[model samples]
Target: MTDVQPIVRLAARGDGVTADGRFAALAAIGDMVDFARDPPQVVPGPEHAPPPCRHFPVCGGCQLQHLTDTAYAEFAADRLRRVLPGLDPVIMAVALSPPRSRRRASLKALKRGNKLILGFHTEGTHKVVDVQQCEVIDARLFALLAPLRGLLSGVLADGQGAGVALTLTDTGIDLLLANVTADRLDRIEALLNFADAHDLARLSIEGPAGTETMVERRPPQLTMGGIAVTLPPAPFLQATPEGEAALVAAVLAGCEGAARVADLFCGLGTFALPLSRQAQVLAVDAAGPALAALNSAARMAGRRIDVQHRDLFRRPLTPAELAVLDAVVFDPPRAGAEAQARALAASVVPVVVAVSCNPNTFGRDAKILIEGGYRIEALWPVAQFRWSSHVELIARFVRPG
Candidate 1:
């Protein structure tokens, strides 16, 4: 083990106690190569657990597993505060119970020996975790885990190995065989027989290179917080039902009412279409297929959405266009947008809202907006990715010019 003390410091807690001048056991969210540059500390009091994955630090699948849930949230909130020290976020209630959330997830898979192991990526690596059961799966899917493992083992005992993920529902589960293709349907047919015999309820299996809708029959769509959203095949939607609703509510509460709005890095119009009813919105994203689905959904919802498939990174919103925008919101991927953040900061829109999955990047970009004459109004944290310690956030920025 390398000595991480020099770079590590204790974090601050509002109601939490500090020991020996340290904020407990905190990990500095600094540069990977140079850990000494700027590190965020983890609180030491809470008991930290190694994630269920064996490939913990090596694979980099779960970054914050070592932190206790309390410590983890504190670190997340602290990261935001450090970036924009003026804005201290009010931490909301965390969905601590499993099976109560996570309606769907697009999981990776792998076959080991004679068993199919199903779990997320191991730490930072591509290797799949050899999991007996996931702690953070849908409640219904949680029950099907053992039998499905057995079914895979029995059906393909002596055959070639592969991995599969299940989409949970109130009725049953939908299984997706990631590596299997139509060419191997004869063999897949055999597995389906075994699943039927074993009674793996409503298991719909498919391959990566399949037809228009790989799901065959569409999966259960969710109405998260007054928003009628459909789960189209493999688009990136939140796993948990409650978690998704909470996130959308937070974003909506930020954008009370505004006109000539823009949502950058919008995915499936998660925040865009819903907010459209309140304002004239333009949703821009790079994924052509996802944007198409969003357009279809918008049409179905009887809502007007200006969908544009453009790379928000390479071609960011110019100040000229920003000059007309009254409000802005974005649900960017893990790698937050530095370029778009800059543009939003320079925009004439007095109110700017940013939604991000990664805290470190959000912290970095929030610091930029703060310096650009924007005062952060409210910072809200949401723990949608539970058990994994991944924190999501939405911050409302106001430019008083």
Candidate 2:
């Protein structure tokens, strides 16, 4: 009908919003909606594209797959813009990773009678999608799902499920199965055979006692900044390589001429190892194993990266300690580095690059820094979790006189 209202934008949770403040599910920007019915009907628009994945709508992995590239980017950038309304920082183009680029994901594998369901949980529900196909993960990763289902079905009894984490490493896929038991000897043998046949780099299972390594065909390593670091089991890493690069580039650009830099909350030296090329870097994190791996990689490469195993949340570097560094870069987890940001605000550090996956926490931390006399110079959003509400951003801040 001529009275249809067009969806103007996508809300924070991936629902399309109309100018009249109505929300429609699975609708995209520019799509027309007929509000005459009790439930509005969405008519496809030029900005709406067919979702390539057969598992769309059913699979909870992605939400904005129906939106065009331009529309998707806008939704991500709008998140940051809305958070910092007062500032006009340079907003960089969204770095959207292509479909099937997700390097790591945790999947649920449940065995029911003769059938084994393996994939993401259903949208807002516990039901498994039993993914026949996926578009959000690497082709190599999706290919392994079928084999994983087959292998898991052999050991997982009916009514039982295992939390499976698969990560693509330098050598091969590293798998970690939680809530797994080897009470039956045959299951243990089957697991070993599966690892060998699939040439998995490492396979670890968790049971009542503790986590046990079933196979370590080769050390699962991730090479970053020319250093080969053997990652700890299921370590936190960038969801996509493209997103990591974008964050690294933003951090580097912000710390261009600094002589000494401190990488706070540095997990596995993602930025520390790379920033060390131009400046001496002090890498700090609470995870001892991660720091150990980073230190080992630096030593093997003959690079002197100062690694510290300390909890920043409990004992963030003080202003006196932070004053020594020319610049600082912090990539905190989703909860963000609130106390650390406060300390940085009080410090004499000239440059800071903040990377975060959670925009809300980022906004909170950014405000703390801004109040502490730091000016946001650049903002870049990396949509690695494509088509999802999840957004990652890198913000550059500089201390002004």
Candidate 3:
């Protein structure tokens, strides 16, 4: 008889593990794994769920689709606990974004003979899955897939490939095509006609030269706080609107009663604009276009936000410079804000809100703050990537008054 082991928990890469140090792909918690076979076989458990999308386990877009919502939330929270084992902070419940809420996605397109394969790449491979339907992206974005296929068929030569970046803004879909040429007059006219026909807010193409706006029926805009800011070509945005709201709420809660605040790495002022309503805000980022958009929006709305273009990674604000701020909110990229967190740790800032998409990096920064006499008051695990293994979080670290 083959010895069976019960799967205990999910690993960082969405693989199920057992107490005896066995791993099974697509296995859920409470599932039984039989190890007698060359490769272990997973028996469906109570926590197992039927993936809503038919492309599950094939498309690299999502990983934990086999997990029930409850189990998925638990997985997200468990990931956080694993990363920050020694830090006993109050971890709030996981905030999971609903299906079809993703506002942006990048897809691949390849023309093979008369057929055009367009979709996300398969896991661990560059082969495109040719998605017929997707449950992750917004319905509006998915609706453009068919139209894009038809358009690309005429533009792409056999064996040629291109990249498609789709973003849903307040006005409409903002589309950017990469590695595709539109030098010919007919191709340029087709692009313009396609933009007009589809009612695209903006359409741009990136070729050997650079990005050129083919058409801008309307400025692709996003309303942050109450200010409408023109979105630069493919600006960094939160995966889903719900996730952004949750992060913003957590940050605002942490920085409550703050008189002066600095929003570090504030891309297009998602949190800075809202934080400015009650406090004086200094928004800083490395991207000039994002800062320019934020500055324009702030000026037009009569909101006071001092926008500065500076790379935090290269030159993080020093402890002396941070002394004047009542609160500091920094949402760095996946690399996390190591240098900025160190500066905040050594500073006298009363409230510090650290927003991160990677738990491992956040854990390292949290320890640095703790070593600097700051206590983590609260931590919120946000599953913005939904069924994927990625997990985002917002933590509050404060120095005792």
Candidate 4:
């Protein structure tokens, strides 16, 4: 009889591991793995779940869909615990976004002889999986797939590929097609007709020449902190509305009494706009369009937010500049905010709210802050990307007064 290994935990990349260091893909915690088999077979455990999507293990969009909600939450929390081992900050309950809540997605499109395949690429491959049904994205967004297939069939050349970016804005769906030509009058007309028929908020196409806005029935917009801000084409947005709300709530709670705040990398004022309500916020970012949108929204709403267009990577705020602020909130990209974190560590700011999508970088940055006499007060793990390996978190750090 082969001795079965019980999967104890999940690795950073969503692979399950046994107590003795064996790894199994798609194996959930508490699952039993038979290592004797050519490819270890995983016996479903209490934590294992039937993946809701048919494309599981194939579609690169999701990885841990085989994990039950309880197991998924544990996976997210475990990621933080593994990354920030010694810090032992208060890890709040995981905030898991429900299915069919994703507001944005980037899909691949390919013209295969008489048919158009439109969906995410297969795991670690460029091959597009003609998605018949998707469980993660908004149903409204998924509903457009059929029409999009019909529309692109006429636009794309044989054996050609294109990129499709779909975003659910406040007004309606914002569509951007890349690497496709629409210079001809008929092709352009087809695109315009599709946008008008589907009531697209905005539509744009990108080719070797550049991006061109073919149609703008209505300006694409997104409401941040109760303020309506027109969005730039395919602007950065939190994956889901529920996830955005959770991050905002955590950041707000962390900087509860701050009178003056600096929102670093404040794209489209996700945190800055809300922070502006209670504090004088100085919002800074490198993206000009995001800053412009944020500035326009702030001015129209009569909010006290100073928007500055500066690349934090090249020139992070000096400690002296950050010293005046009571609290600082920085939400950088996946690379994390190493340079900015160093400056914040050296600053005399009382409170620092760090929002990160990568745990390893966040842990490194947290260590820098701790080394500078700052202690983490709380950390909230958010499963914004749902079943994917991606985990986002908002942590509060305080310098002992």
Candidate 5:
């Protein structure tokens, strides 16, 4: 009859799963589901809590808000456990960022007549949710939404839409507007006045001529490990400070006592700048703008960091070059570094730290290193993008003598 099937856990996409294998949305652990009917019905259980944000199951920003704190943390940890089984890797910690702590976000804005709608896209759809309040982004950033909508109403043409990427930097908010046009000079003036009124550190617009900076009161910067990195326009910044700290700490722990290190895919020198305080770090990445910014910051900070603008996938650091470094740290994008991992496997570097946002790719890379005589020592999972299936982690490996 399937009278009552208790939901035991949550799936990767935030859907609750029953012990017998039924999926239900907006269901949490300890919830009871009745699958006897044509469609299942979910009844909230003890672990279910009220979602803090008004927009839940609608706005795509958050997914697991209905889960209690304990359950939420468990869900994040399970993400890693599912990938690395029987390895018994040391679990250092599972750091979770608090609500309203995210420093960077990209939102969609569509102008419908005189009204301007601004918020995240609806779950799995291009339709905008028009969020009134967000639980995952900083309060300072959320406060700008109303004012931004007001300004966007005038900037966007009828039925036109734009994408806004907002980041909270050291100086102030850095905003990048995409698909926005200013046919008249007054539109440009309005943008300048808006930046002036809000004291924005920088404001850039993407039009037919490409991205053009409208205002820059000061260079937008973000301090990582005591080094000030000048952020490039729409550069990749860590979503949460807590998640970044966890990753840096893990990387530094793995890199302890090394005189020389290599940071591959080093975006803006997140780990390189900090490791430079002790070791000589050579930062490599394909991103020219990011490398240029990192190099400038290193020069300004008087740190011994060599920035190399090279695509690792196309031309990974060979075993000979990697052999010179005492240790290596690579934080590749979601698509893990396959060719680079193979190169690293053949290298004689004693220690290697792999940071990734995707568990599947991390596992594949870990397998390659393990087969090449590297021992997985520690694993630290970080829930930087809170309440979502997205997970970031740092795995430390050491080659036996």
Candidate 6:
């Protein structure tokens, strides 16, 4: 809590409960997780940044923002090594994307009356802080913080125990003002006008089901790899354009001649389209909307891709159903694919590339594939989210006799 306290750190500190019932290693991540709330006021870095937001260290959003760039990446690389111990591949390169402006989703704390308050969770605990300025937010979205504060301040009689949620993308902003009733639609609509009046490209009002509806669901227009793509408020678009390309490049490097490839849990085909250059892609996801978006992107790019909607978790595509896939890019959610991991390892496919955000799950699943006679060929640890104790990694495991 204070600067004088010596740092108690863990090399592979984790979050969440582990099998032994301890938090997952917070320190052992490719991202930064400083145990101290307020970063030391005296630490040195580029003095050019817009002065540190008063909540810089107190807000749990970004860590190590004050650390020098070189120092930060080294801190990140250590976490990557601990996470993916089996590959032992040299880091090809650490691509530093420009600082963030592309956060599309955020949760807020809520309050009411003299007690009205809606913001982010406070440091160390689940309590919420009345966030005024978020350094991590984009210029467009960041500017709305105060206006949103004022909007909520007037609309809500009191927000003592409530909270709000938000979304920001290239297009505009979305504020999920909580605790709204159908009777209050008029006042809420007026709030949307206020957001629009502020030159917000677009705004949507979302809340508990019936009480919430999109005032404007203008999906953001974005282009990637020379292909135009659009996404509803949600879908896993890489938060930064540079990070997206870097990740795609990593996936593509491993995907050469990967004929009849299966893109698991594919969101918007970041990997699928590029891989399709010399291969046929079968993109699968449970979300119909995301699947639809993928198909459109493929079409817009003049590339052919087969999109399937299915819950890969409950049921992965049966091995018999798989085409003659020479290689596979399995990008599943954090809870790594135990069933599919085993299935792919057992399959006749020669290569399996896994892109994961969680290390423990990746390690366990990689262990599964390795047991099935697959050998780790390469490891690519990506530091996309630099401020949290989390990192994304891509690994290629080749099947063995």
lDDT of 3 at 144: 96
**How well does candidate 2 score on lDDT at residue 126?**
96
Query: Candidate 6 on 1-401: residue-level lDDT in tens?
Result: 54222222223432322233333232222222333544322222231122356776566766555444554565556666765564576665665555555555465646455554555666578877776766555666666666766666656656434345555555655555555443567775766677567755344444556334545546565555556666654446666566677778888877766767888888877787777777888888898777788788888677768888888888987666654787888888889888888777667888888888888898889888888888887767666665545567788888776
RMSD of 3: 0.9
lDDT of 1 by residue, 78-192 (tens): 6455655556655555433243367665555445676676556764467766555545566566666666666555445444455555655433455655445444666567666
lDDT of 4 by residue, 42-81 (tens): 9999999999999888989999999999999989999998
Give me candidate 5's TM-score against the actual structure: 0.97
lDDT of 2 by residue, 1-401 (tens): 44589999888888989998989988988898988866888999988989888888889988888988888898999999988988899999999988888999999988989999988997889998888888888888788888888888888879998999989998999999998887788988988998999899999998788778888999999888888889888888999988889888888888999999999999898899989888899999999888899999998887758999899999999999999999999988889999999999999998999999999999999999999999999998999998888999999999987
Model 3 regions more than 4 Å off: none
Regions of candidate 4 where Cα sits further than 4 Å from its true position? none
Cα error, residue 160 of model 4, in Å, equals: 1.3
Worst window of 10 by summed lDDT in candidate 6: 40-49
In terms of lDDT, the best-performing candidate is 4
Superposed model 5: Cα runs more than 4 Å off: none
Q: Show pairs that collide, candidate 5.
A: none
- Candidate 5 residue 1 C-alpha distance from true site, Å: 4.7
After aligning candidate 6 to the native by TM-score, how far in Å is the CA of 30 from where it should be?
Answer: 18
Cα lDDT for residue 110, candidate 5: 95
Q: Across residues 1-401, which tens digit of lDDT does each residue of candidate 3 receive?
A: 78789999899989999997778999999999888866888889999999999998899999999999999999999998998777678999999999999999999999999999999998899989999989889999999999999999999899999999999999999999998899798889889999999999999999888888999999999888888999988888999999999998998898999999999999999899999898999999999889999999999999989999999999999999999999999999888888988898899998899999999998888888888989888899999899999999999988997
C-alpha-based local distance difference test score of model 2: 0.90
- Local distance difference test, per candidate? 0.62, 0.90, 0.93, 0.93, 0.90, 0.64
- Name the 10 consecutive residues with the lowest summed lDDT in model 5: 84-93
How does candidate 3 score on lDDT?
0.93
